[model samples]
Target: MQIVFYARVSTDEQTAAHQAKQAKAAGFEIDVVVADEGVSGVSTALADRPQGRRLFDMLRRDDVLVVRWVDRLGRNYADVTETIREFMRRGVIVKTVINGMVFDGATTDPMLMAVRDALILFMAATAQAQTEATKEAQKAGIEHAKGREDAYLGRKPSYTRKQFDSVVDAFNRGEAVAAIHKATGISRGTIYRIRDNRGQAEAALARWAA
Candidate 1:
């Protein structure tokens, strides 16, 4: 029963190594990592992605599949729920790094199964909602930039909102600057800036990722 870490790096700012580190920090000893880079989870199905397709073929009964969250499996509600259920049916244990959530099909209790399924549905819906909100925010930011007298929107932040959040999370977890830099692919200078003035850094990120 090997543990596999699956990463969907949808954006330039996202990195698979960062996620793998998170999984390790959460006490998971991963044996393999499959990553699909430059893939849009919001638009692409897991099985349709190159690495995602490989993932389906590679997983075996009793194997463990680890993801950053339900969204990494599928961004939308239907896809997320279906992907999870399919894995469960195949005897693959699904786990998330975010909350250390485990979805295994080793239960016979009807009520417990119901609760688990409901949680999956809720998490899937929440993932979809977050995706929609990000899209809307990006649209708003672009429109706002276009309407501005100056074509420049400040420095056009070097990092995305997700990267900024990752740094903050690492900081809160007591990770050092170098580790955060390695995990996020962000520069030491930027991390220091964030450390010194988190409020200002967040304001800048909000404006850019608006």
Candidate 2:
């Protein structure tokens, strides 16, 4: 009956601690806090996240996995649906702090199951759409960057490269995702991107290492 709280942020400036505090305020006795920083939810898959992957690995039957929202679980339709279903099948109860959404496997009513599944599918699809829109926006920004390459002095990096490395090291060592977010202020989306684009992020980090 362990309760696990998961939070994520997109940059080092945002802390998951706030989310954890919210979950605690909601009456969840959190046994662990998992946070992923610099993980962009828009492009990163839940299954590919370091802490996300660890969640699947560490979660046992009857454990409660609490997140701020379904979006926190993922932003993609297929990924979100699949992840939730898998956890439900494994006897994990997925709960959300914002809306008190609960998805469990114990329901025997076929209609209830169908409705639950459908809701999950719809929400996941919406999350995916949101992510896609974000990607397009980033693409536009990059294009803008290219146009100004000559006159533009690049903005300072959001974080020192070493900090990114440290985050990754902590992730690899199985540090809780919530802890990482609290310490680094990185968003959940950014954490996912970090896990998905380790090589690229590492390269960026190297370029910004100072």
Candidate 3:
């Protein structure tokens, strides 16, 4: 069975290496590392991420999927629990490095299963609530910033429209979407749009540039 490690950070400045090292130290023989950077966990759904989608496609029956935490999977509780259930149903084992949480589909004890499900649900809900709170804080900050545009000036852009364009170009050239994501830190939805409908992505990018 293949062993996979998935890590995510919301900013490009962060590296997944720390999480990778922790997983390795935990004795998991990781065969692949799928990571998403510069993708907001609170704003982007797990399944909608580039590396996240790749993980879903690459994982196989009996393969062990390791994550730093349930929060890495998603910020929404329903999405997080549903994602875990879907993987388990596919015969994949879900394991977390944090707290050593394990969810396997082979469990026959009803109580154990119920407890596991409850914990997953609870974690997911908490994540969603936290995300919502963050969004509210951001909204407040932006409104405050609007009153003082000059004060917000001189701050570096977290990401640029040019970087996203390069990712789209690479994708259009038939490069692997996962590879492009690893290199460019663009969102999966953007990659999908570029792959499925180049015209739409270009138009969206034009708007972003404006």
Candidate 4:
């Protein structure tokens, strides 16, 4: 049985090599590497990915599959849960680098199976919830940016959309200007500008959101 590592990179800055290095650092005896670069389909099935399909073909009963996290298996809760369950059913052990979790189907105990299944459900649900939250935050920032862009203000916002969102969120949370600056790595002057003129700042963020 092979010990395979799967790396899925969503951004250009993320690298399979780096993930492999991390896995090695974690003391996983990796025998093979299967990677899908720039693959971030929120609803895509693991079987559908170009390299993801290779997993079904390569993995066998008792083989160990390692990933950075449960989220890397799939994006949505259903997909993640189903994929892990399927692998477990096939006697393939699923291991995660983050916490050294091992999900194996070698046992015949009913109670243990019940507990494992419940844990899988909880983790998958958490991953999906996080994905939804990120999309909402991005949407808010984008809308705010568009508002500023249509207004055609000459003084453009210096901060990126992410930075603008951070500043806005910090102020709305009643954080001090100095605290916002420190947390978001933005200048005090810019944080004050974002705080003092909320609408204008959002408009700038919305424009950059596009």
lDDT per residue (tens digit) for residues 97-139 in model 2: 7657789988789999998888788777866765564345345
The per-model lDDT (C-alpha) reads: 0.81, 0.72, 0.73, 0.77
For candidate 3, the per-residue lDDT at 48 reads 96
User: Count of backbone clashes for each model?
Assistant: 1, 22, 2, 8
- Give the alpha carbon lDDT tens digit for every residue of 1-210 in model 4: 899999887755457998788789999999999999878747677888999999998899999999977877876898999899899889899998776778888867999888888888987887777666556655665765553535655566688765764565345435588767765677898888766765566655556442
Write model 1 residue lDDT over 5-47, tens digit each, in one string: 9999876777899889889999999999999998888889999
Once fitted onto the true fold, the runs of candidate 4 whose alpha carbons sit more than 4 angstroms away are: 150-207
> lDDT tens digits, residues 1-210, model 3?
999999987654446997798788878789999999888776687789999999889999999999877878887777888899999999999998766889998888999999988888877886677556434533544554454534424433333545644554344334577866776787766667656754444334333332
For residue 199, model 4's alpha carbon misses the true position, in angstroms, by 14
Better of 3 and 4 by TM-score: 4
Give the distance in Å from residue 33's predicted Cα in candidate 2 to where it truly belongs.
0.4
lDDT of 2: 0.72
**Ten-residue stretch with the least lDDT total in model 2:** 201-210
TM-score of each: 0.74, 0.64, 0.64, 0.73
Q: What lDDT, from 0 to 1, does candidate 3 have?
A: 0.73
Candidate 1 collision pairs: 137-210
Q: RMSD to native for every prediction?
A: 5.0, 9.7, 12.7, 6.7
**Candidate number with greatest TM-score:** 1
For model 1, how big is the CA root-mean-square deviation?
5.0
For candidate 3, the per-residue lDDT at 21 reads 88
